[model samples]
Target: MMGQPPYSRTTIDELLRLIERAGLFERQPMVERKIMHYSSLQTILLVGEGNFSFSSALATAFESAENIVASSIDSEDKVLRVYNTARSSIENLESRKALVLYEVDATRLHEIEELSTRIFDRVVFNLPHAGYFPGGECSKEAIKKNSELLSMFLESATKLLSLDGEIHVTNKVGPPYKKWNLEGAAENYGLYLKESVSFQKADYPGYMNKRGSGAKINRTFRLGECETYMFSAV
Candidate 1:
């Protein structure tokens, strides 16, 4: 099903304030509550979650024991070589009662039988790169490939999001990444930006950066400068 129109809107400052309140950042800006509260009924999905690298975020989210699902395009074999954890990482996620699926394409999420019937309140993707190494050149082809990947993911994710639900993607802010025009891509799917906030690596205790596709490859992310973007159906 297509997503409903977007409603809520937020500025960068307001977004940062909200994320800070959620205890998602390394240092709390000005917390007025113990934690941003949510019901156990909320559902979350993480696409392109390699090796459970952002496992800490998973842990925090798992605290609610809500309907949490994590998908990665890479197979278990690839995860082992790239993430160096074997199946243990994913096993850990499953142990926490998370729905872990491999060979699951973010763009094809609606095709899964177990997931097709479900709707999530929050969906997240980090450094949504097709397959680029750090300090790499940004060719026109590379940019196009990245955009296409994002376009596909947004198109599919929106269909699985509940009304008022949001899709959050965290990404670096330069070179090839900036050219992706994530906001514009979401807009193409009738989604609008609701918030944008700074992201800190140390904020999530169990988080790890992308390990690329091979053991020899380097990480594809920048810790402090990245920003978290939330888009809602519109």
Candidate 2:
């Protein structure tokens, strides 16, 4: 999930625009729609959904799929708007299956276990709003804390997944860095970094400008390379 600070309005807006342009907004929705159309699955869980914008888009795209559950944890009032919009869209579905929505902390596995009674075939953490917020520190302590929080996120997510299920994650690779080091933390939690999809400069929208240039650049790029990672259970 994207764990940036939630207070950077410019950064958040730009990231959402970039996400829309990159087709990520539709990618998972289409996958869920197709899977439900041709296969059989009872439930799906979306964790750390932030504003639930992506969840709303997925609901619209997969309206025909039954028993789909989407959720998020945003104490902010804006999250309610997102929930209402998605809930309204789901009312048009031909099937009468319910889409559960809740406001709960993701780091607490006991809360999740209490909220959701079933294992999910698909679990998603698009991006979280923790590390990159306005008050968040980029110091050594903050990075270490962020890493630990990310590890906890994985641990809780694993508990919600089916044995053969997959977890799809996306994150910006460090600038000027070519490889991501997932050896220590990921291995400690029985999770593996699967593969990364690289996008060229043209593939990302409004990311050409350097940082602090008044342009929004959430995904960092150096030497003309930018990417996001996908992880799964070992």
Candidate 3:
């Protein structure tokens, strides 16, 4: 049977507002755009885009990608948010670009391959933390689930990547960092980590509301860690 949806109306609405107000909407676009210029990839795939915010950034970055496919799982209220965000991004691009968006379990490779129809030059995984859900609970079960999901996501993504394609992943490693090591997990999926970059607290704009928030911060701090990794296909 299908599992219950991941989000609710109130939670979805609140997250959306926070994302917009926090300027994450713009941040995602900027990140993708920069990567586009830096990597010079011809095609890209995005997995687990909860609301197309990051996808929008990618769209702006690769205006003429050979192919672009994005996927997310939408069961309950998450469906509303995902659809709305994706639609908004699509409208913003306003170009008949070869972009395909799917509402599917991001961990499923067959589904992704079906939609993409070919290997991609770039694959991205920007997943949610274990405790980001409404229940606000994190357990071994949850971590294991996320790990398995990520493993499958990588397996399929690699299979669909071009010979020299690369996979990019971003995740938050919070306090008591004893749960799951994403870097280790990626290796389990047969991906070799090539490079890792961290964005310091000073590097990004302050957390939306702050006393001296003018421009986005570009320095590191005790909290707020952003990690990016480039992995080669095996």
Candidate 4:
């Protein structure tokens, strides 16, 4: 469920190297991977997964996917077709007994029969954005659509969240993302920002951030200054 500007690149490291070579950005030291915040014992729900790599990474880290539930907005068939590695990821999740759902809209989590009565300790949505549009990522239309999606998702997620659980949304830190003003949107849903933490891809060993849309749906995107914004219900 992440939306990103059209990029044909393969990996963040490759893109960063290109930037450094062009002298646009100075090379910085590599970030050490942080320990994952989600625990294996916790009931976790991940939404809007592009290729389910994040879920697969978690399952591998935990040595089991028994406590995890992963979902996608696209149909299972569509996911398999678009993402080159999806079949194996889904297989891994399934083999580990992780609940895998398809076409589960982010704005209607509670309405799903399988999810209606469940509560999760950690609910994560990574790189949420509206699908590609004509005017590109910075267009007013893009921001508005993405903001509305965030707002509705928060409202829905609040209903399914455990009393002491957290809702996590990871996104790029600046520019068009900042314009979305997630803090303001959370307040509208009676949720408050608890903290924001740096999002390092290395933290999730097998996780690959996909463009998640358009012709390059299978391609990875550059993650610049991304942070995981954790929110709690008021």
lDDT computed for candidate 2: 0.51
Which prediction has the highest lDDT against the true structure? 4
Task: List model 1 lDDT by residue over 1-234, tens digit each.
Answer: 999556445566688788889858667233222112223356778888876756435545545333678788888777776676536656667666777778888888899787898888888888777875454538787788788889999999999999989998988877767888788899899999988888777766567676465444435444658899989985
How many clashes show up per model? 5, 6, 15, 0
User: Which segments of model 1 are wrong by more than 4 Å?
Assistant: 1-41, 64-66, 86-88, 133-137, 218-221
RMSD (Å) per prediction: 13.8, 18.1, 17.8, 19.7
For 160-223, candidate 3 gives per-residue lDDT tens digits of 7788888887655563233556667678767798887773433222111111111322222244
Error of 3 at 89 (Å): 1.2
In terms of TM-score, the best-performing candidate is: 4
Give the whole-model CA lDDT for all candidates, comma-separated: 0.74, 0.51, 0.56, 0.89
What lDDT tens digits, residue by residue, belong to model 2 across residues 102-203?
566666644565545567666665433244435334555556555665667677777777776666554455621222233345567787777667634443
* Candidate 4 pairs with clashing backbones: none
Predicted structure 1, TM vs. truth: 0.76
What are the clashing pairs of model 1?
5-233, 5-234, 6-233, 6-234, 56-206
Measured on C-alpha atoms, candidate 3 has an lDDT of 0.56
Q: How accurate is candidate 1 locally (lDDT)?
A: 0.74
Rank order by lDDT, top first?
Answer: 4, 1, 3, 2
- Lowest lDDT 10-residue stretch of candidate 2: 205-214
How good is model 3 by TM-score? 0.63
